[model samples]
Target: MRPAAPEDEPALDAFFGHVDAEDLRFRFLSAVRKVDHDQLKAMVTIDHDRTEHFLAFDPASGQIIATAMLAADQSFRRAEVAIAVHRDFKRMGISWTLLDHVAEFARWKGILTLESIESRDNHDAIDLERERGWIASACPGDPTSTILRMTL
Candidate 1:
């Protein structure tokens, strides 16, 4: 996996296009049928300092198979992280590896905390986060969501 670049927009879009609807909803925390070009652009165009995106490639196919995003708050003390792996790539430890990568990046960026706001229905992701030592709590205003946090 490596940091995403502007040139990766098309590949990122294609990757999201092939992702399952449920996976997209888990990643975005909403019912998104499709990831628009503008949104894809925003993801790939990273500032590196505050917001960074990373993509994991299929070694054999050279296609983007997973993505991780880290967005730090204005104070640079806390950051939100999100990750998604292709349907075919699930259960291969890809998500775990990507989460570790993002956490390392967050620590290097001087972030004190890393958080993931996940839908309540995304039990697999929440479980994975818990396995990685993140604390899970119900989101205050959103009963449908859970917040997973780790202090770096």
Candidate 2:
């Protein structure tokens, strides 16, 4: 896996097609039918100091199989993280590895806490995060979603 760049825009667009629609909604926290050009642009063209987007590539095929993004607040004390794996790559421990990698990366960047807002129905992700010591709480005014937080 490597930090995403502007050149990765096209690849990310294609990668999303391989992700399950439900997973897409989980990643974006919305019912997104398709990713647009502007959304892809915002992802790849980020300031390295405050935001980092990572693309995980399959070693054999060299195809993008997953992505993890971390965006820090102005104080850099906390950051929101999001990740997604292609449907074919699910249940392969990709999400676990990516979460670890993102956490370590956030620590290196001086972020004190990491947060992920996941849909309440995403049991696997919530379970994995809980096992990793993340605490879950209700999303303010949004009963359909839950906020998971961890301190690095």
Candidate 3:
């Protein structure tokens, strides 16, 4: 895994192509048909102090198979993380690994809290977050979603 660089936009965009529709919705928290160039640009071009986007590659094919993003608040005391993996790479423990990696990175950077906003319908992700020790609560004013939070 490595931090996403500006030149990695192409690869990141292509990586999202393999993310199934439902996963895209879970990642973006909306029904996006395709991840736009602007979003890809934002992912690659971020301030290191406040945000991080990581790319995971397939060792054999050298293709990007997953991405994990962490964005912090103004004070850097808390951050929200989101992850997405290519459909072909599911069940390989990539998400679990990335979540742990990102949490460690966040802790190293002095972030005290980590959280993720997830759709209630995304059972696998919600379960994984809970299994990883994140506490889930109903998202205020949005009953369709759940918020997973952990104090690091």
Which candidate leads the pack in lDDT? 3
Candidate 2 residue-wise lDDT, 1-152, digit = tens: 99999999999999999988999888898999899999999999999999999999999988899999999999999999999999999999998999999999999999999999999999999999999999999999999999999999
Name the lDDT value of residue 94 in candidate 1.
Answer: 94
Over 1-152, each residue of candidate 3 has an lDDT whose tens digit, in order, gives 99999999999989999999999999998999898999999999999999999999999999999999999999999999999999999999999999999999999999999999999999999999999999999999999999999999
Q: Estimate every model's Cα lDDT from 0 to 1.
A: 0.92, 0.94, 0.96
Q: What TM-score number comes out for model 3?
A: 0.99
User: Best candidate, TM-score-wise?
Assistant: 3
Pairs that collide in candidate 1 are none
Would you list the rank order by TM-score, best first?
3, 2, 1
- Stretches of model 3 off by over 4 angstroms after superposition: none
Candidate 1 per-residue lDDT, tens place, 30-147, comes to 8899999889989987688899999999999999999999999999999999998888888999999999999998888899999999999999999999999999998999999999
| Model 3 lDDT, full chain set | 0.96
Candidate 2 collision pairs: none
Ten contiguous residues with the weakest lDDT in model 1: 41-50
